[model samples]
Target: MELALVLPIFAIVLFALVEFTLLFYARADVVEASRIGARLATMPGITQQNVEAEVKKILPPQLGQGAVIKTEMGKHSGDVVMVAVSIPMTLASPNLLWPVGYNLKGQNLYSETRMIKE
Candidate 1:
């Protein structure tokens, strides 16, 4: 009886662990994309479109076009250029923990990177 009772709980925990692992991995990718975008933004004469393209390229394939990328350039040469990226996370599989209200879908993961203009 104990085996039957604990098996489902273990299975749910395993699924939840896998789901969170994928989400964290995706989050790391988003952070790297923002850093790359910020690096690109630091260069002079780079338009918003160019930065966005590079950022989208850096982002994981799962993100698709739902990502929002914003770039801001300061007036002076030595000023900061910031790149902000936001992506909505979708778990790899069905949320097994949803029965307990542990849904993690559709949550926006945001990353901002700032670099000084060259």
Candidate 2:
């Protein structure tokens, strides 16, 4: 009887831990994608369109669809180039014990980078 009572809670905690790990991985990927985009923007003659295309290519398929890329080019030489990437996160459903589903769902993961134009 005690085992049965504890199993549900244990399972829910495990599920939540796994879900959070996945979320962290996704967040890191998004940040890396943004950094890549910013680096590409720093290259000579690289347009915003090119940067966006490259960022999408670098991001995973699921994130690519929902990803938003924003680029800001420096007005003058030796200035800074900025790239921002945002991905919407949908949490795993049927969360039995934790409120993570409500807290994480529909939230956006974002990353931004700035580098000097080269």
Candidate 3:
């Protein structure tokens, strides 16, 4: 009887673990995408749209669709580029014990690099 009572709690914890793992993977993808975009943005003659396209291509299929990217040019007289990437993660269902659903937000990944214009 005690085992039966504990089984559901164990199952929910397991599900949450799986969700966290997925979120970590998505974070890695975001970092990779930001790096690629920053690199491309620094390249001479690379249009903003082209850089965005390259960055999108680097992300995983599911992430590419939902990913949001914002790029900013350096204000000073140097080649400093900034890229911010955000991805949303929605839970499959509400926790068996919680109200409606517990939404865990994905972290925003950002990368900044300075390069010599070629």
Candidate 4:
């Protein structure tokens, strides 16, 4: 097996692994942010803007940037507050021999947390 032929494949695999890890981190951050936001919602006289700020503070820098943060206050009969965070995944390069694509639109990280308001 020629090292030249195998090196590119190895590189692609490594890139894919790194990309997946980043996505995982983003997802965790979003979930944590949602949970934090929901907790804030349970506070008395807590404004939506304050909750939004808390969510942004809890999220990672990459997840916070260009990310959509949504909140549903008393959307359910139980007065459960719902928070959702989403962000699109972008690839570093597209020339690799893998499924990596620049601006992969469908790739999104999201989280939902529900809590009763106090």
Per-candidate Cα RMSD to the true structure, in Å, reads 1.7, 2.5, 3.9, 3.4
Q: Please give the ranking of all candidate structures by lDDT, highest first, separated by commas.
A: 1, 2, 4, 3
Tens digit of per-residue lDDT, candidate 3, span 1-118 = 9999999788878877776677677777778888878777776677778867887899877677777778875444456777777766643222232332655444343444334433
lDDT over C-alpha atoms for residue 56 of model 4: 81
**Which candidate order results from sorting by TM-score in descending order?**
1, 2, 4, 3
TM-score of candidate 2 relative to the true fold: 0.86
Compared with the true structure, what per-residue lDDT tens digits does model 2 show for residues 14-109? 887776777788888889999999998888888889999999999888778888899998766688999999887663222333454445556788
> Can you list the residue pairs that collide in candidate 3?
none
Candidate 1 structure quality by residue, lDDT tens digits, 16-51: 888788778888888999999999888888888999
Span of ten consecutive residues with least summed lDDT in model 1: 88-97
**Which one wins on TM-score?**
1
* TM-scores, one per candidate: 0.89, 0.86, 0.75, 0.80
Structure candidate 1, residue pairs in collision:
none
lDDT of 1 at 62: 68
Predicted structure 2: lDDT? 0.82
> What ranges in model 4 sit over 4 Å off?
75-78, 91-103
* Clashes by residue pair, model 4: none
Better candidate number, 2 or 4, judged by lDDT: 2
Segments of candidate 3 deviating more than 4 angstroms: 74-77, 91-101, 105-118
